[model samples]
Target: MGRKNDIASAVIMLGVALFLAGCPKQALEPVGAGGPQPQAQPQQESPAMTPEQPAMQMEPYGGASGQGAVRLDQARQDFQDADIMFEYDSFSLTAEAKKVLAEKARFLNAHPGMKVLIEGHCDERGTAEYNLALGERRAKAAQEYLVFLGVNAQRLSTISYGEEKPLDPEANEAAWAKNRRAHFVITEG
Candidate 1:
């Protein structure tokens, strides 16, 4: 307990020193613990056209009604519930995977405060080492694509579960097809 206090104190001191030394306030926002706090930006005038590009709609949030929070909760759930599936033994993104990823990128862009964890999984056919490596490749591929789509690289992370956890546990092509996927998890928002 005493050691933990000393470490915490040292960290606080370092933070203070950095602040005094002119680090940007926004860059120091805490990660994981309390999630990303929403920034308050001044409202700007809007002129709209183009049916192809939909304008961002504002929703009532906080205060007396909790609808906004509920909507956000649902959106987060949907984001993770939607998985990016890969073909057997392949880390390459399919057309369907690209479409899903594009929608995910749009969601992430809207919610800049979110931090996502991309989990790479595999079917049981491969050896453990091979599966792990393949899983890593799949996760990195998704991360790279997301980064290319304008998500902050710092806001995303990746881990390989390999063949350990499968969405469908039965030994068959259908189950294996389900298992070969890159799953999304919201670590913080």
Candidate 2:
């Protein structure tokens, strides 16, 4: 602890000295023709340069915004878009789903401040009640896998959307496959 304090003190002293040295002499000078003149007019800031607008702004996958929110939203979309599929009529995650969850776990671990909601969805087939139950199972399956992969359980929540929302609304095998999956939304970052 003594050594850490000494190092911290030295760093602080060095920073103060550098800051003093970096002071502009012109700033101290009187404002006159013989002294430093007024600066040129400032240019308008581009949207990307603004603090409120991120440079890599993406189409938000869900409603989330604030400091580091764009990055959080992107991460959420990337996880949900990993194609973590389940077998027809089953809530159990496949091998591919495990692989996707592993990647999501890594992402979540890196951003400990982030919180997310996992939405469970299903293909249009079973009765509404059955689909809702299946959806909950699917969401739980994902949440459990994430917890096993070392993500904090407190940072995750689950919801069952059942078949109410579909990525592809068309009545076809392709659309059904698209709809039967878990989705992610970032609640905080």
Candidate 3:
């Protein structure tokens, strides 16, 4: 029994590693070795903080405040936080889902270079096979709606988690409703 359990654990770990390896590339920001990072240049504070204060501040590139970075971060947060929800056993988009997708479409249009991954998920009431298909349909529904709203289809990819990943694990209508959603991830920009 112990050996069997060990093998199961090993298999699960391997599956997770493989899944992560197959996932879309990380954020547009460079990663690992050989990536050039912005270096900070020492600059005098502009009446905000006196030099007498023993604190160091880095000047942003291009002489602009970090407002651009902040805005981009907020936009990314807003994008990921907004999920397109669906009814049980149905892949149809509600009016609210369409509105949310419209807002997402606007964000995508503003950031033309961004690429996204849409993940479809489901409640825990169905067989894995059935849920996977339903989840895929839900994801595709959202993707189609985004395309209809003028966001390029090429920028979007879809995957279904089905009942494998529930937003709320509790067995209740609210939890089930929360789990039936299409989530978003920014793959690259």
Top-TM-score candidate index: 1
Residues 1-189, candidate 3: write the lDDT tens digits: 999999999977755443332221111243222222223212212332333322222221112344434445666788999898999899999999999999999878755668999999999998999999999999999999999999999999999999999999999999999999999999877
CA lDDT for candidate 2 = 0.67
Residue range 8-101, candidate 2, lDDT tens digits:
9997765543332222211123222233221321121222233433323322211222223434444556765775677778988888889888
For lDDT, candidate 2 versus 3, the one ahead is 3
Off by over 4 Å in 2: 1-76
> Candidate 1 lDDT, tens digit per residue, 1-189?
999999999977755443322211121233323332323221211221223223233322312243445556667778999999999899999999999999999988766667999999999998999999999999999999999999999999999999999999999999999999999998876
Please provide the root mean square deviation of candidate 2 (C-alpha atoms, Å).
14.8
TM-score of each: 0.70, 0.62, 0.68
Model 3 clash number: 0
lDDT scores for all predictions? 0.74, 0.67, 0.74
Minimum summed lDDT over a 10-residue window in model 3 is located at 53-62
